[model samples]
Target: MKNKYYLLICLLLSSILGGCDARWDQVLRVKKVQPIEKIDLQGIGAEQMLPVQFPGKSALLIASKNKGVLLLDSNGDHLVSAPGRVETLAIQSLSQGSLLVAAYDELSAEVKLYKLKGGIDRKPVLQYLGGRDEISPQSALCFYQNNDRTHLFTIGDDGLGHEYLVSPGPSTWELVEIRPLYFGEQVNACAVAPFNEKLLFSQPPIGIISMNADAEKDEERKLLMQADQLGEDFGGLWIDHSGNYLWLTADARLQGYELKNLQEGSDQTIYIDSNYYPASVGVIGKNIVVLDEEVDSLLYFEYEPLNPPEHPDLQLVDEFIPRIPASAQTQPVSSAGDAADDPAIWVNRLHPEQSLILGTDKKYGLNIYGLSGQLVQQFAVGRVNNVDISEIQHPTYSAIAAASNRSTPGIDLFAIEKSGKVEYLGLQKLNMKDPYGLCLYYMDSRLSVWVSDKEGELHQLDIHLGQDARNWQLKHVSRLPVEGQVEGCVVDAQNGQLFYGEEDRGIWKLDLHRYSAGMGKPKLVAEVNTKSLVADVEGLALYLHEDSGYLVASSQGNNSYALFSRSGTEFIGNFRVDMNRELGIDASSETDGLAVTGANLGTEFPMGLLVVQDGRNRMPSGRQNFKLVSWQKIENILNLSSATAN
Candidate 1:
């Protein structure tokens, strides 16, 4: 009888352990990564492809890991890969059939350059630009042709920008007539395009300057636009094939101007709503391709004709289903529930219904919902502060949620699956005061997460989730002192940097990997003088339009937003969201939640879509209870001189 009892006990134990193993398996399954859905426009390439500019006759090129530059033909059938690896730092195609590539040399401080013929077989062009030397090959090189000669212009770390004239003398090439362009201020990058044997140089926080090919005498420079007030990093510039129109990326927007009118101080600007941080921009035929390195997505937008092609009155062409549900039904499945706040979409393969939607409720628990708006899983996290999703690996995605109580303060980890199963991964125990915002990114090829607190401090947490997402762990990496309440955070992986916005202190910059390695410290890049723009700032976005860059921040007070150049030193203009005027409501409207979408100009919903929170009528009163605005109307509002006049 004792032996029989032992056998039964063993069977029961095995059953319980098997159940736990199954639960763990489901949680790790959440890591499966998936590709985002693509929206197609006429004359646009696949959404997954990064659009790059090639030389004449060739419209666009896409970067490949193994192959060099893959040229995209008209039929999309002839795929040709160029020979060299496309450097992420600097890649520019010169008019004289040469491509300039920039990469880090043996010493991290010096940037090396290589000149390639037909996108392959690179030859070392320029070696190291010493620390004291003003120019570093790391700067973005602009190619322009004047009087049958090509010129390369770039700004270095020393805040001095130079222009080099390339003279090809039948046998060898030489860089001559190098002259100083911009001084005192750092030139992030410059864009050059030819117009009637003259080159147009665009320096942000300021407008465009035209330089002619005169070796001995200084060329006459003309101001195309006034940008000093717009904050120094306004955006990049793009000139069309005919050099008729100039495009600028400013404050989460794309503005186009007529080239001739720009020279005469009669430039007409049209705004396109682009939400992603635009890093680089290119013109492919009539379509505009923008790369947002932060979001890891490429956008293709076409120019709309002065007159409508088919339908002039059309506003919206098509509307895709909201990846995140407008409202989630709150109910307790196995644990507890409360009102949901801050819903974020996770697009990955493991939990595919778009994976998961994470939010917080006052009931001290983190809520997880499936794509169908059903509560499949719940975690007992204490007062969820903020949540961020990072794509780790297949069958093992990680969700970092900051949870803290008055007594215990730390971040909780949850490994979940599409089936609503959840597992409690360990937490990074930090004695922080009040952790509020969290942002995650891959820096230096390592999975790192950053958390910001109310006391104006940012902390980095290193997450170690094995390739098989089943096991996960977290370790405290580093912490940096900051100012104001850190609200919004983003990581520029391409540049290996991290940015956070202070409620009243403006924007702060930190070297992610360098800080993680305990080598460098965080520094202040720009301060949004609260006395100037707005009182309370919440959200921050760095939009890199082609070579130009813009830093956009949200001012919660008076429902307005401010634009600055990429460096965050200069102010461009202040744009107010008159919810009452736009929605025809009262002054009681409060704006929250902003997102930018990219669409072709000629399409029905060209420009893109802007999602905002409407407070006119909250739940249990209004029909939809929220407002989703189109980008076209927002563009019209932003472009209005009176809206930004204050």
Candidate 2:
């Protein structure tokens, strides 16, 4: 009986110890003592801090739980004061001695906007700017500024958060809703790393979580440190001056995490005497200042981030690629989430300057944009994925548009009048299991459209027009069998050459004459090699030179366009479309279908233009849209100006 009781007691002890992580009690034992200094705020209140600098002023912007804001020097001397009853503060730093301030108003659970101006030995002044009528909770809020654009993030206890684009107005600042993000649990503290666009939030009982701060990016939360891993209690969180270390504070301790690559975690724990309990933390110059309310003082620690960010080879390769800014972008598609896919250019022969851009919203219909990137027309056709427009030498119509309709499981054909008018010719039911890619090929006065299913089945159909303007017909031509899936295709009318992308395989070229005679099969023209053409080759467009031109294909895997010589079918070069700060367009990625025209269409497009589908729409992030790049810029970058000069 004594042995049984002893065994049961041992089992109970093991279960309790297992349930309660022993590391939770190890924080005090492992951390080493560090030298520290303090500021006595015994009566004033919170030292919740942020660092700011101007032309002639540089100090820590201190926040008080009740007494407003104060500017404290490195030695803890209060230099400036602004009256308000705010517990938290966020700053959006700007140039010319101006910075945006967000002070949390507890009564309303919202934040009031203020613009601070102080420089050239002048006293800093804060202005009461009008803010939005509705807002998220400011209890856990921070500002993320990138490329001179400021964004406000507010997270609530319910794990719901709102992200806003902060736009300054005449006497106010506009808060535009970009997206609503979820944190999934109660948040203890939060911080933002602008350099990598990462949002780190501490969710107690679970530990720290980091996610992409950009609404246009993947917003999946990744656990950086588990609750058991954070040996100490988490009180405050802040990103260090280098934007490399994500520092978390607790009772007498600090944990710095090198978050260059979140997947490869590297961190260090610095534990101090347990006499301090930090409630606020931030960076001032190269030192760390922690607000410890237990003694009503701010503790300053002389510390620097330990290690440099780890950059893998893939990251280096990404930085090595040259970026080309966009000059203009079309109005976003009406639908969202992978809706916009392909674009087709419809050149008005009568007024070539007024050529229109046709884009497909795979979720809804079609959209047409003008040269200046304005919405001209929108059609509610159902789920058209890939679209192509070509000059049709028909009696009733000058041009026609063809697309693969996933909703109807058929082909949608439309006619374009000489005056830029689009009339629906209706859908042509086909024998396709799942039609995915469609392209129009106009050769020798004959108009044909090539359509492909997701399973690599390809079919060509000749389009015929009746005497009536809206009456159009499609007759099945010959079928071309491919090995795998295909999407992008283009035809060289002058050379009777047809090029199609087999996605994972590569680009294939088929001779129209040989295929017509049933002699040979489509041969691989370009393999989806990592050197140039990445897998899932998409959106093929031919730039017609004097005689032989260049074949531009979308290297979908890499967000680049690869150029191949039409004469030898050899890869020449590739270029990526990058962000344009002036135009507020983000870099193009995961491109779908693209269309290029070599004909000089007036002054704006003197050397024609290239319209490619922007897979991800960002920078004041909205829905997806098509980006237009000048052929001149592409030629100049690739040195194709001399090659295509003719």
Candidate 3:
């Protein structure tokens, strides 16, 4: 009986231990994965735009067309709604739990202020009117605090901006000062930040305006790095926590200015290319949040308060070929081969060396090529003009095309396999006047696709697809009106700068951040002298060698490319392309499309390859074919061959 009892005890112990062992096994096999939660806010229609988080809170203020403010928490939960039919609204909260909302009526030409009890959506307890009770609030309103006191400022349509103090005692306020903001021209938006006893206000499209609380006398704002002089638009502005460093986003670049001495302006201005058009700017923690509305994505960078922030100075180390080769040429296997035009190369970020070259041919439809320049696959997409590819979190790839038919007049998105197989995704009818160039960039932490109309307008689109690619949503972000006619656009991935090329004019740079401010204008970097280089400059590329300090720009008409020193605005030599004798050379004219071949040619080919359009002018047949030539041969023509010849 005792032996039997011992056996039974052992069995029970084994069962308990076994269960524990199984639990341990399960724990070991468990994988910790981050959960993605998406909160949807309804009632907010397409007209409500520019939803921004309120500083130091979980609430967000949205611009609405319904003439009211839509308030919500950070988690997309609706809090309350403030009703007003004001043309424009600006919100700012003070340390004393008081919120100020500035509303402007363009049609009525009046500026009204509403002091809310709770927040932006709370009921208004006080109101103030500006400008003859008839003048509209034509300028952007900004809020600033000095010594526990808050001030509200605005620029009028007459180019004059005024400041008022909100006395905290009751609901009473005082018109402290009314100063004229002279920007040499018209002012679009004004921003003010506290600097000791005085305030720093920026009247965009001109310079920085400074004023003190005590109006002993008024002084004209000094030109702190003139916007027009820099040849770019004022994109966005931000003041650091310590109020020592001022960040400005100019066309195709971001600049850091030291505010140590207000009288001396910024001690140093460091410029960086943002690889995309920076439309707006906000602060998230210590990172500078830049919004590129063109691509509908947000870029984050660590903010440095030093006189000159330490940044990557990408220079052209060598003009040699990259080790990677272009994807193999693809042939149309589909029946709709006669409808494609331009082919764009999309490199996989996860696999830098791996890329997909997509082309559009009228007869072949859309063709995909491998990195080796070999045809991988082909499919029909009606008639395609341009193609773009984007990588998402999922394991799938999304391809977009600007196509047209008898009924449709815009671009569409398609689902593509990593292996180059194409499937019809969805069509986006932009109803644009003339859509030509299509580019994609990540903005606001989302993938945004930009389609440019040759008439100088850009349409920002958001592409969303339901499960199984059944439906897609394409929402327009903003329609930007450009100055000169734009032909092609390239984003500087290293710095977030956007380079826009024109046909007769040179390249224009847009500080995506500043553009988002809805103020200022685009600055011209290098004006194209049609009489010298190329009559019509179109394509642009920044070739940064691993350790070198040079950048090269290719011009199609001059049949040559120019090199510039990376540090300053000095011209190096120019390299001519001898396409007159090449196979696909057309005597009529050279056109757009330029790319650098990423392959090492040890002996014969040497410094990679330069690809361009071989103007053949044949209409269905005149669509120029792309030509590839060795960069080494071109360098020899530029008079640098003997110096670096191996």
Candidate 4:
């Protein structure tokens, strides 16, 4: 009996430890610490804040909202002031002990550079350097000099960061051609490490991120560390003079982080007054100062690194499960011969919440579903392999829809009613054999359709609406020859560019206008030789923002999605969809087609939605179905440019 009891106790202990591990894997551990409020800034308010020191005295440089920059001592005694109200400010030290201060105004989106001459004993003279440039005034600016050139990096409210180079000749600055790095998080504060050009940016909820200052590639902005979620109480962030620690003010506490293993957890924390929130924080030598608007005082505290006990056996796990992410499975479409092959999202302009998902049932036709995965409409048009949707304004009716008809070698036209139902209009017969994939392009007050086949033949047809809004006619515009079997294709209406994936070789791009006119040559965007992109690059989709975008391709051979710059096809990163145990859906593999939309689609997909055909929906047992992945999850995992992060 005693032996039985011992066995039972061991089992219970094992279960408890397993449960703890499961919970730990779901969320990251955030060490919370409080700092004591020390000194205050008796300035106007915090529009911009910077910490400065000269010769033998330390001062706080406060750029008041509409009052300008005030240089004040530790006790709030005003020493000097620069009269120019600005949105943000950046300071750089010159060789001769002179200071260059650049102030930006949001209302004008202009930056004015000023040179300050002299010391704290006398009121310094401010000289305009004639260095003016346009930038997002709402962003925080940081200046760093490299190779005799001054570069100003801005963290924008849109989460799209930009960098500008100041010319040594005139006072001119030019925007660098670096691909936009989307943080997907509002950067509350930022700092640069002069040692290796490393950048540290802080955001609420997730903590701080360190990326290379000259991050021209996506992999360079790797995740470093995540701090406690301060919610709405997030404050400013600063790196110490030694570049070994990062300081942050959040939840009324001034926190310091040591840089040994940044990807694991924060190193130290100091608590301050709970009643006052630290609006801005800066560190000078061994003293940390904070600005509290509620108390109308500047608080300073002596800083010291705290030594915390280490948990040698404790293992830290990232919130994401490596490259796999959880996803939701749509209701299955029952048809054989690779039935569920492709999908398209149709936004309901009336009730965006009621947006419908249109997927291809290759053996049958098109299947439409509600946001809840309930099949609402199914059109038996005939062996449709791929489907794409675009809004076309007709005189009598509002829009018309089109799909490639693989069974009969033609294109099927339809009209999409506001009620999420598609009405078949007519069919435009094509001379091509075995239509495989199709996409629609609408721009310049015209609509055109592109279709590809198994033999690598591509055709562009300019669709014209006849007198009766229901009648449609296709005008053969151009035909292009490709190397291998082709299927996936998409057009960037904004830039008039065409991108298509050649299953066995790689992805290619060409000018849409010139391609439609049969006058342009195709350029290889990415090839299968790349380790990140396997052979059989199946589906291609474009994620477009107002100023930037990314091209996502389904690397079918590897079961991962590869991203590239939409402008020049620059390689970004790759990710895969994994099983969501709670949702009872399996990981996607051997995907054939995918579609993405930036439009808001209710709560489940407030940011956007990515629908991909899951070749093995349940894996080893169930039928194929489409999977629904929250675009926000992909953004956080890949740090893609997303307004949702903002």
Clashes of each: 23, 0, 72, 14
Q: Candidate 1 residues 366-416, lDDT tens each? A: 666643445666667666655555544444434433333222467666665
Worst 10 residues of 1 by lDDT: 26-35
Candidate 3, position 5, lDDT: 50
Q: What TM-score does candidate 4 get on C-alpha atoms?
A: 0.49
lDDT for model 2: 0.74
Give residue 239's lDDT in candidate 3 (0 to 100): 58
Off by over 4 Å in 1: 1-343, 348-357, 367-380, 396-408, 415-428, 467-470, 513-526, 529-533, 541-552, 563-646
Runs in model 3 with CA error above 4 Å? Answer: 1-341, 348-354, 362-364, 370-374, 398-407, 414-416, 420-424, 465-470, 542-554, 562-589, 596-610, 617-623, 629-646
Model 2, 578: alpha-carbon shift in Å?
Answer: 5.7
Q: Residues 44-101, candidate 3, lDDT per residue (tens digit)?
A: 4312222334334434444343535555554555556655444345556645665676
TM-score of the candidate numbered 1?
0.38
lDDT of each model, Cα atoms only?
A: 0.47, 0.74, 0.49, 0.69
Error of 1 at 96 (Å): 64
TM-scores, all candidates, are 0.38, 0.79, 0.40, 0.49
Q: Best-fitting candidate, measured by TM-score?
A: 2
After superposition, candidate 4 runs with Cα above 4 Å error: 1-327, 395-398, 516-518, 642-646
